[model samples]
Target chain A: MAVNDMTKLTLGPIAYHWSADTRRDFYARIADEAPVDEVYLGEVICSKRAPFHEADLPETIDRLERAGKTVILSTLAEVMLKRERKATEDLAAMETPEIEINNAAGLFARGKRPHRIGPFMNAYNEATIRWMAGQGATHICLPGELPADAIAVAAKAARELGLGVEVQVFGRASLAVSARCYHARAHDRTKDNCQFVCEADADGMPLRTTDNSPILRVNGIQTQSESYVALLPETGELIANNISHLRLMPQAVDMVAVATVFRDVLDRARAVDDADAMLRSVCRTTPFSNGFYHGKAGYRRIAMASPA
Target chain B: MSLAELICPAGTPAALRTAVDAGADAVYCGFQDATNARNFPGLNFTPDELAEAVVYAHAKDAKVLLALNTYPPAGKVDLWRQAADTGTRLGVDAFIVADMGVADYIARTHPQVRLHLSVQAAASSPEAIRYYCESFGVKRVVLPRILTIPEIRQIRREIPCEIETFIFGNHGLMVEGRCSLTNYLTGQSTNMDGICSPASEVDYARHDDGSMSSRLAGFTIDCFGADEMAGYPTICKGRYTAPHRPEAYYAFEEPVSLNLSRLLPQMIDAGIHAFKIEGRQRSKSYVRNVVSAFRAAVDDIRAGRTANIADLVALTEGQKQTQGAFETKKWR
Candidate 1:
C-alpha cells in the first residue's frame, strides 16, 4: 500500500498501563502478524508508565520497522510534571521514528519538526488542522468525537495542506484525561504510590453508573467509553472524503485479527456485515458503537440500513 | 510585593457591573454565541452589551477581557474571526482564546490587543505555556485547575507570559480543552460547543422512596436521597460504581467547589500574577459575593495582615469545597 493511501491502517499507542512483558509480546505479534501499515509505539496515557516500557522501545521499533511498518513514537497526552517535560523533550529530540505529539509541550519541544498530531491533541476543525500543518505537523488524527460533517471538513483541509488525516476506526474512545488518577483513587491510593493498580485491568477498570449500567472505563487518569468505536461501515464515506488513514487503538482483545478484519473490509475483499461479525467474535463480549460518526451519543450503536 | 490581580467572572452585563463594583481588577466575559465556553440560555453578554460593558468597566478602572475560548467548528472559523474583530472594535482589554487557529487569527489581525490563553487551551506545562507565549505572543495564560502551587511556581519561573490561576468556584478537575465525556453522552462537545452537561439535555426524575435522580440524555448521571442536596448532574461530579468498590462513589470528583482562600498568601508569594474565579453560569449575587471575598482576601494579604476570609460554603456546590490539586498532587 502507498504511504498516503486512504486504506492505510495505523495502530494507536496503548492507553492502558499494561505490563512490559505484555506490551513486548503485543508489539511482537503486531510486528509479525498484523496487517497494519503503521504502528504507533510509546506511552500516551500516564507518564509513570513510560519507565516500565521505555527499555524495550528500540527493539520494538526495529521489529515493527523490519516488518515493513512505519513506526511513530507517541508522547504523553497530559504533560504536567518535571519528568514528563523531560520525557517530551527527549522524545522531541529524536530524528527517527516520527513522533506523534499528544500535548502542546511536545509541539514546543519538537518546534516545527515534522510530526503527527495524536488524537488527544484536539485537531477538531479545519483551522486547527491548518495551524497544525503550519507547525510542521505532517499527519493529524481527528478526535473521536467529531461527527461526519466535521470530519469531512477537517479531512479536506488536511488534504489541501498535503497532510495525512487519520481517524480511530476501532477501540474504546478516550473521553477525558485528568491530572488526578481515578485508577489510583479507585484503589484508595494516591498517584505517587499508585502501586501500578491499573496493570491489573489490562483493558481498563470498568466504571458503571450508579444503576449498574456500564458507562465508562477508567485507565489511570484517562476516561474511555465502554464500547469500542467500530467505524468499518463508515470507511467508504471516510475514503471518499479523502481521509488518509484508519486507526485502531490496541485493546486487550486479539488486535491482529481485528486489523485483518478492517483490512479486508477496506480492501473490499469482504462485506462490512461479514467483517462486523468477525470483529464481534474476536472482541468476544465488548459491544461495538458508531454513534460518534453518526453525530449521536458515543455509546449508541446506530445501525446502518440493510441493502435492498 | 505586587498584589495579584483579582479577575472575576461576569456571565451577564449585570454581573459585569456587580463584579466591577465588588472590586474586580478585571471582569472576563464572553459573547452570547458559541464563541465562548459559557454558552447557555440567558447567560453571557451580547456584542452591544459588551460594548457598554467595556465602557462601564473602563470607567471603574477595571478591564474587560473578552473570552473567545471555544474551538470554532470547521467552515465556521468566521464566527471566531468575527468575534475577534468585534472584540477589537469594542476595545476589549484582552482576547482569552483556546484554539490555535483563533489565537493565530487574533495575534495576526489584532496584534495590538493582548491575547490571554484560556484554561480551555490546557497548556499545563512550562513547555506548553512557552509555546503559546513565543508563537502567538500570548500575554497571559489562565492556567488549568490541575496544577499544584509548586508546579505553578516552577512554570512561572520558566515561562515569559503572566500566569493566572483559579482561586474559587467550579473545581475543574478534568484537563480542559481535552475532555470529551460530555460530548460522548450529549453529542455536544465541551471544547467545540462550549457547554458541558447543558441544561437543555438535563432531566430530573422523582422516585417513590422520595429520592431524586438526575440524568443527561437518558443516561443516569447520579441519584440523590431526600436529605441530600442534589447538585447538577455534570459528568465529572456524578457518582459511579467500579468493581473495586462496594457501592457507587464520586468516581471523578465529588460535588465540591474549589475555594483557595486559605492559600491566598502563599499563592501571592509564589508570584501568581492573577487570581481567577470560575462560574460564568452563576448568578449576579454569586459574582458579587465571590469577587468581594477574594478582593478583600487579596487586599488583606498584600497589607501583611491575616486575611479575614468569609465563609462561602452556602455558595459552593453540595455545600462543600476543596483546595484540590493546588495544595498537593495527592488530592486525587
Candidate 2:
C-alpha cells in the first residue's frame, strides 16, 4: 500500500517494562516490519527503567527514521524526580523529530518548538486544545476515555486550528497512573528498591477480585483495563470527525498484524468483518470493546455489523 | 504568621453549620449533582440549600468553596457549566475545579471568583501545577495526597500558587483526577460522576459461613468476616487475587485514612498555605470533632507547641490510619 493511502498509525510509547535488549530489538523490528506510520519512543512509564535503554535509544530512533517512519520522543506521564525533569528537558532541547508531551514538563521544556500533546496531558475541550496548540503542540492525542461526541467537537476544533488529532484505536486503555508502584509493593519491596520486578510482566500483571474475577491490569505504576479496546469499524466515523491518527498502544501480542489490520480497514482494502477476524486471529486475548466511545461502561463490547 | 486555613467538608447544610461553628476557616460542599466527587444521595446540598449554606457560612466568617470537580461528560458539559455559574452567583468564595473545561469556563466568565485546583485534577508535580496556573489563572491547588513533604516543598518552590494539602482524611493511594476502577465496576467514576460506589448500587449481605460480602453493581468487591470491620465497597480498596498468591490481597490499596498531624510543622514550613480535613459524609459529631481537632492542631503548630494529635485514629477509614505518601514515598 502506498504511504499516502495508508491511515497514519502511531505506536504509542511502551507503557510496560521490558529488558533493554528486548525494547531495542522490538523497536528495530517495528522500524523494519511494523505497518506503523510513526513511533513514539521514551520512558512514559517509570524513569528508573529509562537508563537501561538510554544508550540504545538514538540508534533505535535512527533505525526507525531510516525505515521511513516518523519518530517522536515521549515525556514521562508523571514526572516527580529531578532526573526525570532533566531528561524531559534534554528531549525538548534536542532538535529531533517531533516530541509528544505526556506531562506538562515536556510542554515547559519545549519552550517555543512545536510538539505533540499525549493523552495524559488532558485536552478535554476546544479551549484546552487551542491553548495547547498555542503552546506549540502541532498534534494532540485526545484522552482515551473521552466519548466520540467530545472527540468530534475537539476534532472539529483541531481542524479549524489546523492541528493534528489522534485517538487510541487498540490495546488496553491506560486508566490511571500513580506515584506508588503496586508491582513492587506486591512483592514486599519499596519504591526506592522496586528491584525492577515489573519487567518480569512484559504485558502487565493481571488483578482479580476476591472471588477471582479479572478486574484490572497493573503495569508498574499505571493501571489498565483488562479488556482490549479495538476500533477497526469506527475508522469511518473517526475519519468523518477529522481524527487524523489512529494510535496503537504497544501490547505483548502481534502488533504488526494489528497495525496491518487497522491499515487495511482504513484503506478500504478489507471489510471491517475481515479486519475484525484478522485481528481476532492475531489477538492472544479475548473480547474487544469500544464502550468508552459510546459513553457506556468501558468494558462493554460494541460489535460493528459492517465496515461502513 | 497567618493562621493555616482549616478547610472542611460539609456534605449537608447541618454539616456546614457544624463545621463553621466548630471554627472551620472555610467549608467546602457540592451541589446534589454529578459535578462533585461526593455525589452520594442524602449527602450534598440542593440549589436552595447551597444558597442558604453560602449565606450561613459567609455570616459566620467562614468561606464556602463549591466543589464542581467532576469531569463533564462529552455532551453533558452544560450541567457542570451551570453548576459553576450557580456557584459563582451564589457568592461562593471559590470554585474547586478538576476538569480543565470547568476551570477554563470559570476563569473566562467569573474572573473575580477564586479558583482552587481540586486534588481530583491530580496535578502533583510543579510543572503540572504551573501549567494550570499559567493557563487558567488558578489561585490555589489542592495537592493530591501522594506527595512527600520534600516533594511538596519542591513543588511549592516552583509553582506560583498557594498549596493546600490534606491533613486528616481518607487518603487515596490511587491517582487523583484519573481513577476509573470504580467506573469500570459500577459505571460511575469519582471524576466523571462524582461518586465511587453510589449508595444505590451498594448492597451488603451475610453469607452462611459467617462472612459478610459488600457488593457494588451486583459484583462482590470484598468479603469480610463478622469480626472484621466492613469497609466501603470501593474497587481499589477491595481484596483481589493474583496468580502467585492463593489468598486475596488489597491490590490497589489497603483501607487507610491520611493523618499528617505529626508532619504539621514540616508541611507548614514547606509553604503549605492551607490544611484540609476530608470527610463530608460523616456525622455532625465527626465534623465537629475532626474540624476542631485540626483547627487546634494548626494553632498549636503555629504557636510552636508540640502539636500532639492522637484521637484522630478513631475517625480513620477501616479504623486505621497512615501518614500516607506524605512523610515518605514508602510508608509501609
Q: Which has the greatest lDDT?
A: 1
| Candidate 2, superposed: residue stretches over 4 Å from native | A1-6, A305-307, B306-308
The candidate that wins on TM-score is 1
Candidate 2 local lDDT, residue B128: 75
lDDT by residue (A1-308, candidate 1, tens digit) is 33334569999999889889998899999999999999998988888888998999989989999999999999999888888989999999998638999999999999988999999888888888888899899999998988889899999999999999999999999999898999999988999999999999999999888778889999999999999999988888889888889999999999999999988887777888888889999999888898889888888899777611
Error of 2 at B119 (Å): 1.1
* Backbone-clash count (model 2): 1
TM per candidate comes to: 0.97, 0.95
Clashing pairs in 1: none
Model 1: how large is the Cα RMSD against the reference? 1.9
Residue-wise lDDT of candidate 1 within B266-324, one digit each (tens)?
99999999989998888888888888877877888888887776554344644678999
> Per candidate, chain B TM-score?
0.97, 0.95
- Global lDDT of each model? 0.89, 0.83
TM-score, cand. 2: 0.95
